[model samples]
Target: MADEVKLLGVVGSPFVCRIQIALKLKGIEYKFVQEDLANKSDLLLKYNPVHKKVPVFVHNEKPISESLVIIEYIDEVWKNNSIFPSDPYHRALARFWAKFIDDKIVTPSFKSVFTVDEKEREKSIAESTEALQILENELKEKFFGGKEFGFVDISAVFIAFWIPLFQDIIGLKLFTAEKFPNLYKWSQEFLNHPTVKEIMPPRDPLFSFFKGIHDKLHSSSK
Candidate 1:
C-alpha cells in the first residue's frame, strides 16, 4: 500500500469535496493537487481526457474521473471502511438515491439559485424546493443509507454542507427549521459528525468560492 496517490481537484467544486470526504473517511493519504478550473492542469487533461474534469483520483499511476466513480474506486481500494449497502436490493436503492441527486436535484437547484431574472428564479426555486421536499420525505426517519454511513450518505453529503451556504448567498431559505425540520436537524447531525466535521470546508470559504463560480459562469456566457 505504498503506491503514490494524488488528487487533482479544484478547491471550490462540491464534486471535488465529495472525493476529499471519501479519501478522508477511508484514512487514505494522498497528495492534494489544487487545480485551476480556468486553466486546467496537464494531469487533469491527461487523466480524464474525455470530460477533462477535476476531482480526478490518481491511484498508483492510473487516473479516475467523476466524483462518484472516484468515490467507489476509493472505497474498493481501501477496505478499512465501506460506504455502501451489503444487500443487493439495498445497494440498488442507495445507488438510486445517488443517481437521483445527480440527475434530478443538483443541476436544477443550481440553475434556480443562480438565475438573474426574478420570474426565472422563482420557477427554478419552485422546482428546487419541490425536489428538496421530496428528499425530505425520503429522509423522514432514516439516518444514513442502510445500516450506517454508506453510499447514499456520502452521495448527498454535499447537500447538507452546501445548502446553508447557498441559502445565505441566494437570499432564499429553501430549507427551514420549521418547514423541513427533519432535514434541518439532520444537517446539524451530519455536519457535526467527527469525520464530516474534520473534512468539511469552512462555510464562508465555500460561499466565496461559489460566488466566484457563479460569476465565472455568467461572465463566460455573456
Candidate 2:
C-alpha cells in the first residue's frame, strides 16, 4: 500500500514554504491541505494541540509539528535527495546556521519591517542588519550548501522570498545589495531555482495580504 502523506499549511507562510521546498526537492508526492488559521480546523488542533499552528506534516497518519522538525523528518525518510551534508560535522554546521538564521535573523528582520513603534523598529533594524552581515560573510559560495540548494538554503527561504515583499510593502531596505552583497546575490540565485519559483507566493496578492497586516498593526499602535 502507498503511504498517506499530507501537509496542513496556510498560504504565504514562509515556515510552511520551507516544508514545501524540502518536499519538492526530495520529489515526494503528498497532499496539501490549505488551512484557515483564523478558524483552525479540528485536524490542526488534534495534530498540534499545543501550538494549533499550520505546516503540520502527516505521514501515514502520524503528525509532525514545527517546520524545522518536519524538514529533518523528511530528509531522514527520503534518502534519495539528501538535504544535509554527508559529513557529520558539516551537517552540524548547517544546523547551527539554520538555527542562527531563525533566532537572530528572522525575528529582528520581521520586526524591523513590520513593527509599528519607531524606536523599537529602529532597534530591530540595527539588529537585523548585523544579523544579515554575519550571514553574508558566512556565505562564501553561490548557495548556502556550496553549489546545491541544501539545508541552510532551505532554512533561509524567508530571507530570499518573504523579506523582499516586506521591504517593498514598507519601503524599508535592510537587505540591500550594497549593504550585504553576498546575501543579496544569494537571494537572487535562490529565487531563480525552479522548485523555489514554483512555491513562492505571487507578489501582488501576497503584497496585499502583508499590507493589510501592516496597516492594521500601525493603526492599532496609534
Candidate 3:
C-alpha cells in the first residue's frame, strides 16, 4: 500500500521548512495542510497533543512530531536520496551539527532578535554569533554534509531563508559575507537549490508578517 503522507505546517516557519525540504529531496508527494497558529486546528491538537505545534508528519494514520524527528523518519521511510551520510562517523557529525543549530544557533539567535530588552538582546546576539562562527568553521566545503545537501544542510534552512527576514524585521545584521563569508555563500547556495527555491515563501509577505511580530513584542514590552 502507498503511504498516505500529510504535513501540518505554518507559513514562514523554519522548522516546517525543514520537513518540506526533506520531503522534496526524497521526492515524497504529500499534502501540505497550512495551520493558523493564532487558532490551531483540532487535528493538530489531536496529533500533537503535547506541543500542539505545526510540522506534524502524519504517515499512514500515524503521527510524528518534532521537525528533526520527522525529517529522520522521512529519510528512513524513503530510501532513495538519503539525507544522512552512509558512514557512521560522518552521520554522527551530521547529527551533532543539526542539534547544535537548534540549541546554540537558532534558539539563541531568535531570543537575541526577538527580545524586547536591550541587554538580553545584546547577550543573545553575541552568543548566537559565536555559535555561527563555529558553524562557519565546520562548513569547510560547499555544503555542511560535504558536496551534497543532506541532514545538516536541511536542518540549517533557517539560516538561509528566515534569518534574512529576521534581520530586516529587527534592523540588525547577523549574517553577512564580510562577517561570515562561508555561511553567507552557503546560504546563497542553499536558497538557490531548485527545490528550495520552488517552495520558499515570497520575501515581502514574510518580512511584513515578522515585522508585525517585532512591533507587537516591542509594544507589549513597553
- Candidate 1 per-residue C-alpha lDDT over 56-143 given as tens digits, one digit per residue, 9 for 90 to 100: 8898999888888888888777778888765788777877888887766677667765776668767767776787788788884546
In TM-score terms, candidate 2 sits at 0.97
Colliding pairs, model 3:
none
Q: Of 1 and 2, which scores higher on TM-score?
A: 2
Per residue, candidate 3 scores C-alpha lDDT tens digits across 1-222 of 988999999878899989988888888899999999889999999999999988899999899999999988888889999999989998888889999999988898788768988999888888888988999988998988788889999999988877777777777888899999999999999899898887787889888877887899899988
Per-residue C-alpha lDDT of model 2 across residues 14-126, encoded as one tens digit per residue: 99999999999999999999999989999999999999998999999999998888999999998988999999999999999999989887888778767888998888878
RMSD of each: 2.5, 1.1, 1.0
Worst 10 residues of 2 by lDDT: 105-114
Deviation from native of the Cα of residue 205 in model 1, angstroms: 2.7
Number of the top-ranking candidate, with lDDT as the measure: 2
Question: What order do you get sorting by lDDT, best first?
Answer: 2, 3, 1
Name the regions of candidate 2 deviating beyond 4 angstroms: none
